[model samples]
Target: MLEIKNLHVELEEEDKKILKGVDLTVEPGKVHAIMGPNGSGKSTLSYVLSGRAGYEVTQGSAVMDGVDLLELEPEERAAAGLFLAFQYPVEIPGVGNMTFLRTAVNAQRKARGQDEMSAAEFLKVIRERAKSLKIDAEMLKRPVNVGFSGGEKKRNEILQMAMLEPRMCILDETDSGLDVDAMKLVADGVNALRDDGRGFLVITHYQRLLDHIKPDVVHIMADGRIVKSGGPELALEVEHNGYSDILSEVA
Candidate 1:
């Protein structure tokens, strides 16, 4: 459902390039994992796809289900079904988590020309979704991500993903700073969302996250481009031998 071709992105404030020609496709219902070291442009790829500002697309196209994501604004991209879970979720101290979520959901609906969900319906749906994700009602009443534990922040993100039900999900290091139990909880929430109508692109550094997420395809990225892609075994190879051997071979 997501296609990126020869995407080259650089910082808007300077001439330094971050992504140098990345091409990837995540077919509907499939899970794709991208593994790379720091500064390899993995997170940049996600940001570019999600239409984040501060990065100019110098070349290539990013299309989601035939819509050119690069041409749309960030909110437009969200309304068109794109979701990115950050490595470190930012805290919005003044806004209650529930209010932020409801506003987001209604905004997406409004942008799509659909009817907004009623308060009763939204509350019931969110309650059910939160319970499944092990999110407490009190947490929902608190300010978004403010004073939450690391695991709580991650789970809150998954909760957001569940509520939005985006067609294309790009998780950037969702496992970062998460404990084993918290990681599993987040993975289970992700797994629950798996279906033939959606796609997932999981960016992570460690194989442990892959153990739970079980990506259908594994890609190795270096120097702002995707250099290699294989089955899940590729992640195991990296875990066992590191990127040195693969980089050497590709070199």
Candidate 2:
């Protein structure tokens, strides 16, 4: 459902290119895992796709479901069914989590010309989704990510994803600070959202996340470009041998 062609990106302030030429296609119902070392532009790809600021797209195009994502504003992209789960979810101190979620959900709904959910309807739906993600009412009542633990923050991100139900999900380092159990919980939540009409671009440094998510395609990215692509075995290869072997062969 996502297609990118010869994408090149650079920092707006520094003029330093980060993504040289990235070409990737994520089909609906497929999970694509991108594994790479530091500075390989894995996160850059996610940011560019999500229409984040500071990164200028000098060349190429990114489209979702035939919609040109690069041409839309950030909120328009969200309305177009693009979601990015950040590595570090920021805290919104004054806004309660439920309030924030409800606002976001209704905003997107309004953007898409859909009727807004009633407060009662929203509460019922969020409660059901939170229960599956193990998010209690107490957590929902607190300010968003204000005092949450690492695992709690990550779970909260998943909760947002579950509630939004975006068609294309880009998870950038969702496993960064998570423990083994926490990672499993996040992965399970992700897997539960997997569907035939949705796609996932999982950007991670390690293969452990893939063990639970089980990508349909695995890509090795180095020096801003995807150097190799394979199946789940590619992740195991990276796990066992590291990026050195693949980087050397590609070089």
lDDT of 1: 0.95
What C-alpha lDDT do the candidate models reach, one value each?
Answer: 0.95, 0.95
- Checking candidate 2 for backbone clashes, the offending pairs are none
Clash tally for model 2: 0
**Taking the tens digit of each residue's C-alpha lDDT, what string does model 2 give over 85-167?**
99889999999999999999999999999999899999999999999888999999999999999999999999999989899
Instruction: For candidate 2, give the lDDT of residue 85.
Output: 96
RMSD of each: 0.7, 0.6
Instruction: Estimate the TM-score of every prediction.
Output: 0.99, 0.99
Stretches of candidate 2 exceeding 4 Å from the true structure? none
Tens digits of per-residue lDDT for model 1, 130-204: 998899999999999999999999999999999999999999999999999999999999999999999999999
Cα-based RMSD of candidate 2: 0.6
Report lDDT (Cα) of residue 242, candidate 1: 96
